[model samples]
Target: MAVPGCAGTPPQGPAPRGPRRVPVSLWAVPPVAALALAFLYPLALVVQQSFTPDEGGTSLAPYTEVFASESFRSALTTTVWLALGSTTGCLVLGFVLALVIAFVPFPGARAVARFIDVFLSFPSFLITLALLFVYGTVGMANGVWTGVTGASDGPFHFLTTPWGVLLAEITYFTPFVMRPLLAAFSQLDTAQLEVASSLGARPARIVRRVILPEALPALAAGGSLVLVMCLNEFGIVLFTGAKGVTTLPMLVYSKAILESDYPAACVVAVVNIVISVGLYGLYRVVSRRAGA
Candidate 1:
């Protein structure tokens, strides 16, 4: 006795119950277990080794000895300054490039953006070598200058200095900053920019107010990444042969491989791991907040 709408509709069968979902937390166990085995276990082993003594019990003697050495102190200072300088340089240059690629209209703008991606795939050491050819005293600029002026040395001695390491670090890491920044820029609301422009807001003002606000997250994330990477950078500093620029990574290598001071090397390595982990945590927080 079904009515036109529903009054007398036949009784339907019971609704089919879908299979119960396993809690997502349960599903996450395997990956979490794998990560613990892969990462945390290794980290724990390093920490344990750092504490282990030659006589075979826990001791802080390694850390005490390593930190007491002036060479360790000098290497640490070099690591910190290099990380900061290179990160700052990368952020500034990368942000500007990202702005140009994202907002400024010009020929081959898209092509330039695509080229930035290529840099990430390239090995950082190659950039160091290329800089050598361009600025290493006997390289092109110097070669031309020497041929023209009969100079004994080229003006481009920075390549052999810490500043050269800085330059190489900046060049290699800028693309890291640019990649995140471009992604953030792409998600920005163009309408706001259009409105600002229509309202006669100057380009710099528009950038300062409308753009920079949205970019801070990417900046934080990228800068932290570059800082962490720079702290561990061995190839550029080593290849540049920069005098007195031994970073923690280089020191760790020298201690473990050359000097065979495993405990001391472990001390330095553990410190680096702590710093990198702290910065990475900061990066994760900022990136999540920014939805980047």
Candidate 2:
């Protein structure tokens, strides 16, 4: 063996060191700080304002007054029913559409499925606008009706109603439900469908037996997300121009902007946050259970 420092051989320096890795905890600091500043800080301010009334002392007077108000109660009722109704519509419509797209082989079926991924990027206002173009007072449907029947005003006045808000919400949010379902459907075993078909199972039976069980987790995940979103949805309601359809978000806007009642606005905002956060936690628990 050569000596430690041979004449012909150049002695090796210390092995080259790669860059030192920062600890994961250290890596997390920037994002944690950013989140605290962007989200937590504002949320804390809002929560603080909710308790500290405009009269200057911290008290529950605002909450008590808001809770007792007829407008608050009406807004609360409208918000809950609309969110629930829209979520139900999205689930049923999304489930059926996902099944057809995933299972039923058809021309451009893949293209339609791909379009759904793009559709998710669309804003809620765009959907509401599109619905308005089709169904607004002087929109295409009414125009066609008026032109055909020589009527002064068409019967399509629902666009300014709560149902219009519901329709717009469903149209916009259904894609959210569909995206998760299509992903879940992709992972499903086609062999089960084939075997079920071979066993003389009817289409409904196969869907009910083989497919529904597997899709439950995705359904729960999508439904929970949709519920939270619908609860916070402001654009669709606002764009629908349904003055009578006062949601919690609208109430918050009305209180803060129109009435200049910042305390009441903060209280409503706090209540909305509590509901959304509670539902989001439920979503997290369900997602963990489903491994979704």
Candidate 3:
């Protein structure tokens, strides 16, 4: 019953698919390959160096030396205290500043915020230098106090002390904490606050029950970042730390530069990396819980 041309041919199956052609670009391969060579290779080298002996033997002698040394123990303790103090100070100041900026309208608020942003862009070293000029024995405060009291002694002897280092860290890292907290505060629902107010809830009650809960994640994240930064700090310490007030970074520097002990330096570096990683992990867990 079929037509003549149709009757001559049998039913055909679907056509077979051709192999997919992957684009091979020179651009794509070079970047990934170059990254492996540059970053990964260097990190691997350091890890190898940490484990291997400087004299061509395998050992954990450097780690033992680091653990047994009284100086290292003292330095580690000092570093922890410095980091904790700095982080705490930054959190308190940054939280208050962020709250004011977010909730309180004032003349030149925008300008003030812009000024803070610009200040953050300035070098930490420059700030340290300014602090030296303002706080050192021959500095402004010293001169003023001496003139007023007719005393030979300075008003504040925080220069080249742990307190000075902590102050510098808080000043530098407060911006980190403030920026995130400000964003968190800005994103809050004003309607909820108004509802609470209308219901005769005290301002303190509303902040405690609503605002803080909402902002906790951001606050924790910012605080954790500042803490980690303080832990790894070196520049401010170098400029401000006293003779016996050696932090972990300063100790590592001493070992590497002063004593020419690369292995011992590596041990301290590894310890720093471990502590940083652990604290960051803890931050992640807390942040996730707060968000949930």
> What value does the lDDT take at residue 100 in candidate 1?
88
Q: What lDDT does model 3 reach?
A: 0.84
- Predicted candidate 2 versus true structure: per-residue lDDT over 65-169, tens digit per residue: 999999999999999999999999999999999999999999999999999999999999999999999999989999999999999999998979999999999
Tens-digit lDDT string for candidate 1 (1-292): 5565587677778899999989978988999999999999988888888887677889998888888999999999999999999999999999998998898899999888899888899887899999999998789999998889998877888988899999999999999999999999999999999999999999999999999999998888789889999998999998898887899999999999999888888899999988898888877886788687
lDDT of 1 at 203: 95
TM-score of decoy 2: 0.92
Query: Which 10-residue window of candidate 1 scores lowest in summed lDDT?
Result: 1-10
lDDT values of the candidates?
Answer: 0.91, 0.93, 0.84
As a TM-score, model 3 comes out at: 0.85
Q: What is the TM-score of each candidate against the true structure?
A: 0.85, 0.92, 0.85
Candidate 2's clash total is: 0
**TM-score preference between candidates 2 and 3, better one:** 2
Answer with 2 or 3, whichever has the higher lDDT: 2
Extract clashing residue pairs from model 3.
Answer: none
List the lowest-lDDT window of 10 residues for candidate 3.
1-10
In model 3, state the lDDT of residue 132.
Answer: 83
